[model samples]
Target: MTKSGHDILKDRLRRAMGIDLQTVGHNSLRNAVARRMRVLGIKETRQYYELTERRAAELDELIDEVAVNETWFFRDDTPFTVLQRYSRNWLKRGRGSCLRILSVPCASGEEPYSIAIALLEAGVNGPLFKIDAIDISYRALRLARRGIYGRNSFRGRNNFFQRKYFQKTKAGYVIAKHIKHSVNFIRANILAANLPILNSRYDIIFCRNLLIYLDKDNQKVVVSILDKLLVDEGLIFTGHAEPGAFADSVFIPAPYPKAFALTRRSAVVCKPDRVSYNRQILPPSLPVQPLWFTELDTARELADTGQHEEAMECCEQYIRRHGPDKEAYFLMGMILTDMDEPRLAIRMLKKVVYLDPNLVKAIEMLALLYKGLGDDNNYRVFKQRAGRVAARNQPAGKGSE
Candidate 1:
């Protein structure tokens, strides 16, 4: 059986960009190819494929279409919180004169901008830190450089950052000049032989959601690249589904819950300096809460660091004090899942869903738990419910993952 021209193009794309067809979907490849073909007025697949082989610029255009550019500011809030804490500690230690951070596949600037905002909220001024944001897509880079964003860029419950950092105009909100100046956006592929930042090492790197889209070999390649680019005690933040890619590497999960941070196994743990909690760093409009509320965060940190027993104890203590809080139950559920206690995790997750029926994460967790437990009927029920909840919660014009 002979492979089609399209199939060969897929192979080419994989080699050129390390994209896993299974992860990104064949439809995306086909759509990108079709789009490029339409632009060039090439009707034949073989003809377009030959052109891509000869012309690197055409191939890059195809890649821009195929790349997923869906992102919002502070997509996962925990990572920024962890970054603030880490930055505070870094400032205290004074290891380096300037803190260096990298955001690979920065995706239309939200992430790197969010990083700037997070650092600013942590009292890290422009002179004290440098952010280098990298992305392959020229289209995304243009938008990032423009530094103006619409509603789609600002999602989730916390919108106070918008009020503090953005000036609303008729043409969407313009990011603060200070925040824009803090980031240096670079257009380059991570898989390139001559990566722009090969000579540079970073104290922190946010390479989230990229590994999940790459093949096993490419995942390893990326991990190696990250290891080389990161300092000994540096932290790397990854997407929720991406940690498994680093299991065979020297990277270990950092003690930060949903932050999805990893550090080198040989990295020395830096003790945090004793600093008073600053309420201003959090959401501006949020009312101050009791100190005991931080127990759940501690539990999550413990769980992330693989202290399952202690995490469970913390969750239990929180539950005893707070009387059946949804957040505590969710944390307990995750901890149980980490401990390989699926049944117990399912029970906790069920309570979380009961307390807040619209909690999609808890619902999805239940679905996964049921599937793991070999209960197909319950799995389907929860999976469908999770889908419904997600659809209801999702904002308009949001791209599907």
Candidate 2:
């Protein structure tokens, strides 16, 4: 049988750019392709597939559709806080002549710029540090170079820094010239054989959240590259959902909050709250009740669909019946989060983490909730825990939802 248009495009994309369109869901890929076709005035699917191969510009556009570029300045402030502290200490000690930071797949430059702002605010001299930011998308790179962002990039309660660093204009908040100059933007593929920065070593590498999109083999490849890019004592920071992928690597988990900083194995130190969530501790192999699992699923669906009260009720019933069920409590916490009750949500989520410390999502949400409440210490602590658990529990080669 002839392959469907989506199947053909999916295979082509997987081969060309290592993107699994099917993994993102068939409908999403189809719709994106349809939109691209409409924009390019290509009515026939077969011709568009050929165009994707023959025309580099067209292929880039399609790849942009698959690329997830959702990011904000100081998205999770924990890492920046860690960076600030580390940079200050490093500078004080005179350990390195200059601090070099790399932000791969930098996603419109929010991260690297945020790093600049954090370090500068930390009293580190602007010229003492340099940031090299790279992304696969030219469009995103263009925006990053422009250094202007709208409301989408300015989120959460931390607008103080934004107001300090950015000048508000009709288009959006324009990043200060000094911050923009501190970061050097480049366009390159992470998996390319000749990555632009392969010869250089960085004090810190922010390869956050890029690995989830890759398959298992590619994840390994990307990590290997990052390991080489990092200086012997330098750190690599990842997303909350990525620590599990580094279990066997030479990187040791750094005990910083939601920073997901990993150091060389030889440099592992006793971090104050070094989490050990990788130990697979499942509830004993006793036969699980199907009905209870079904209720948990129902509650999760309800919460996801914004039926917070109904979900909470379902979770409450489960907890009452099962006696502090981890999943139930976690669902309750998520529901509370939807209901805008951060304290209650934190209580339930903390319970969930205590019951099963490897509940990655619970720990992550707790971090966010704490951040909302301006509890910096707890926010970083839970964020770090979440990264460890996420690294342990995340399946190989799946994209972020």
Local distance difference test, each candidate: 0.84, 0.76
Per-residue CA lDDT of candidate 1, range 267-292, in tens? 75454433322211212222343211
| Clash count (model 1, backbone only) | 0
TM-score of each: 0.70, 0.66
- The residue ranges of model 1 lying beyond 4 angstroms of the native Cα positions read 1-3, 273-401
Model 1: lDDT equals: 0.84
Candidate 2 regions with alpha-carbon error over 4 angstroms = 1-5, 268-401
* TM-score of model 1 vs. true structure: 0.70
Error of 2 at 81 (Å): 0.9
Q: Candidate 2, residues 1-401: lDDT per residue as tens digits?
A: 12675677776666555555545665777777888989989888888887887888887898787777889988777778668756765776675578999998798999999889989998888879989999888878989999989999988557779778999999999999989999999998888787888999898888887877777777888889988888876778899888887889998666443567788867522211112321213343325432122334445545655767766776676666557787667667767877989899899878977887776767778899999999999999989988877777778765355
> Candidate 2: lDDT of 233?
69
lDDT of 2 at 97: 76
**Candidate 1 worst ten-residue window by lDDT:** 277-286
Candidate 1: lDDT of 262? 88
